[model samples]
Target: MTVILERDCVIAGGGPAGMVLGYLLARSGLRVSVLEKHADFFRDFRGDTVHPSTVTVLRELGLRDRFLQLPVNRLRTLDLVVDDHRLRLVDFSTLPAPETFLVLAPQWDFLNFLGAEGAAFEGFDLRMNTDATGLIIEGDVVRGLRATGPDGDLEIRATLTVAADGRASTLRDAAGLVPEELGVPIDVLWFGLPKPTDPPPPTIAYASPRGMVITIDRGDRYQSGMVVKKGGLDALKQEGLPALRKHISDSATVLATVVEALTDWDQIKLLSVQINRLEKWHRPGFIAIGDAAHAMSPVFGVGVNYAVQDAVALSNAIAGDLAAGTAPEATLAAVQARRMGPVRKMQRVQRFAHGRLARATAGQHLAPRWAIGLLRASLPVTRRFLTRFIGLGFLPEHVDRPVR
Candidate 1:
């Protein structure tokens, strides 16, 4: 049986972009529906770094106090271990007070918090376990979406359709909107390690002769990741689990004992990194946001924050049209135009980082010897610039007015 529904806006994928946009639109009194393929937001090892810009957005939405209630680990500074030298790359403390640190929490907790908060609005409807299968297009213009859930087939008619279904978005494919692949040369193998009792410095990355391992403190355990060449997982499997563990141990000697927990291959999850963006992000009655528009590399952990920013920008740009039950045809281009600059700038940074990592993985020094000295000499100036760049981003989006 087909269950038909209508709304001012229909969003496919209840990710950061979709949820935030839906929440803002509904809070503004616009009827909005968000579809989530999963039954719940319990997925692990997703992007969990909530930057200051996102915190500011939460504050603007009047969710500051509630957001602080969630279990979170604060990272004020990011340390890097390059061979025998320790470098302080980023210092968030230099940013505005109170929100000067990065919050590390489980992605699900953050999503659930947003979901619960969004539910209070009467116009918000989040349909879980609903998978968007295709677009409902009419004469080159999208009408809504076709989806499947526990009940049966579903058809949604809306003034506007948004594809936030991630990098591998079905709706994006359905709309024939392909993202231009911005080449990335490295992937990451994520695993868990026992946290030290004494607690070491908040060192986020370690680069040794063996390889690079990124460590994120999760209170009880460390969510660790080992960087490798792109499409290199097969080669890693050939080297065996012990070799992989050895590489991780050699990269960060402090985690040598705890690396034993990864005795089975199943424990390590591979993150195939991709950096891409669409030449265009919208059709007549449809649009795409977040990873659907651009897939970010896990360089500075800015993907989630950027997605949230996109949502905020979209909400600020077209909430009036959506509230009036009109398709935001003209405003769709404006949204893309407003966001493309930041996306392009960040992607350039990611590409540069990838180049450095690729060279490092091939046994080349991550940076020149003299360059390291220069970085050390300019540490103070560098941290300040990086703080604003990473924390607030190129152009931080703010809530225009009280949505409620």
Candidate 2:
């Protein structure tokens, strides 16, 4: 039998955006249902950055203390060696107290932490292993969604529906909202390596004419990703895993020994990085946030952070109308309006950053010495900008609405 459930909001995708949105709305005393397609958030190679901006949001909600209880690595610096110039690209240590640095935790651990928090709210409903199939429309208005779960078919009716699914959102497609894609010069290949007894740098990267390789320390393991050209993975794989290992070792000598730990092709995950956004984030009764609204490049490792920030903005924008059981397009547009500026500025910065690296990948040439000189000259000015932009973003949103 098909189960029909009703709530003030039905959110598709229990990702960072959706989960945070669920937690916020439910805390606002509005019944909110979150549909998660995955049985659990155990997928590897996902975004795990918990930036200072997010820390502030959590602190506002009184959840920061609990989140800190979880085992995580707090990285104080972002150091990268490009063209033999060790640039302290970002200094997290420079940020203000109680919010300095970024926390590195598994995406699953963070999601599970949020799930636990949402569970405490009487109005937060999380349907695990449930896939939201399509939107239910009545007279050009998005009323709710139809989903499939372990039982059978499920339909959730609500005053507002949200698409937080991810870069490829079914709900976004169902609503006929298409993203205008920005060109991505590079893709990424993700793999893991055994952490050295003493790591080189917690968050570091090695760049050469070959390409850029980034590594993030996760205690006993180093999660590594290499930037490659568009449609570059298959050819690279055809050359086999040995080529991939050599590629990393050639650029990042610190990872030489451990790069071989990735023995099989199946072990590495490919991320076709893209940056895109919808022309309009909402219709009358439906809205999209996070990656559903904008697909972020992984360059700054801020994808997860930006998504969570979106949740905060969305909750702040529509909490009143949601509680009153009517979310107009203006309220939804306010969320996008609050978020779009940062999103645009960040994407612009990423394009410029990646554009330089993309040239190296394209030509198999070395990192330009002039570019290095330019980077060093700009460091005096760029340091503050990079630290703030990458660590907290431009204007972080705070939760001001009172929750029941």
Candidate 3:
């Protein structure tokens, strides 16, 4: 038998974005349901860096302490290198509140925490192992969603529908929202390295002649990622472990001492990097957040952070509208108006950074040296840049105004 559920908001995809939005909306007393296709988030080598700016928002929600209690590595500084020279850029020590550093934790753990928090709220309902299939629309307005589950197809009617399904969002495609490609091509080679007895400094190492290696401490151990050219993973795989290891050894000083073997290759995971922005982020009563709306390259590692911030912005906007008894259409417009500028700015910044790093030969040759100099040259500027990436810059008067 098929089930029919009704709610105020139906959020498709139970990632960090959906979960956080669910928590916030539910806390505001709105009936919210989150439908996630995956039963669990135990994926490997996913995004794990949570910046302090996000931590500040978590603190506002009273989840900061709980977040800190989770298994995580606190990184206070970012290390950049080209050739033999190394520079510490964007040291978290200079930033205020929740610590200026980034917290390293398994992405699953963070999402799990959000899910748990959402579940505890009286107005929140999360449906796992359920997939949203299509929109329930009437006259160009999204009124609900159709989903598939164990029993069969289910219909969920809500005032609003939110798509947070990730880079390849089914809902976004079904709704026919086209994403604009930013044209920056970069990929990542991700893997886990055994914990060293004497740990090296927490750092993001850019190897000259092309390649980026980020070493993140995961409490008892460390995880690392090397950035490679787009569609470059196949070539690396063909060249095999010796060549890959040699590449890492030659470019990165921190990774030089890390022993490599063919067995280690088995444990590494790879992902292609892309930056995408939707032509429009909102419809009549349907909207998108996170990667569905804007997928940034992984250069800055702000993907999750920005997604969480988006959730916060949307939740706050919706809450304000609901409080004023605004219509669903009006609320959606308000949300878009509040979010579009920041989202656009974020996309532009990501594009710039990705472009600087996307150069095949020249970038690979000059990146490390340039990065070292850039970081070493200006401490204040680096701190401000990191702050901006984390969503802590001046807002326009319109975005700053409280929803009325």
C-alpha lDDT score of every prediction, in listed order: 0.89, 0.87, 0.74
TM-score quality measure for candidate 1? 0.98
On a 0 to 1 TM-score scale, where does candidate 3 land against the true structure?
Answer: 0.90
Q: Tell me which of candidates 1 and 3 scores higher on TM-score.
A: 1
Best by TM-score: 1
Candidate 1 weakest lDDT stretch, 10 residues: 321-330
lDDT of 3 by residue, 1-404 (tens): 77898788899998878888888888888888999898788888777888776777677777788988998778777766655566665667666654566888898999889888777788899888889999988988888889997678989988778999999998998788989987766777787766555765766755566455666677775677777777877888899888888776665555556646325667778777878888778887788998998886666677777787778878767775654544366666666677667767777877776665665324455445565566667856876676455535323211223223
In what order do the candidates fall by TM-score, top score first? Answer: 1, 2, 3
Each candidate structure's TM-score, on Cα atoms with residue i matched to residue i, is: 0.98, 0.96, 0.90
Highest lDDT: give the candidate number.
1
| Candidate scoring better on lDDT of 2 and 3 | 2
Q: Give one digit per residue, the lDDT tens place, for model 1 in 179-242.
A: 8997889999888888765667788888755688898888778989988999999998999998
Model 1 CA deviation exceeding 4 Å by range: 402-404
- The Cα RMSD of model 1 versus the native structure comes to 1.3
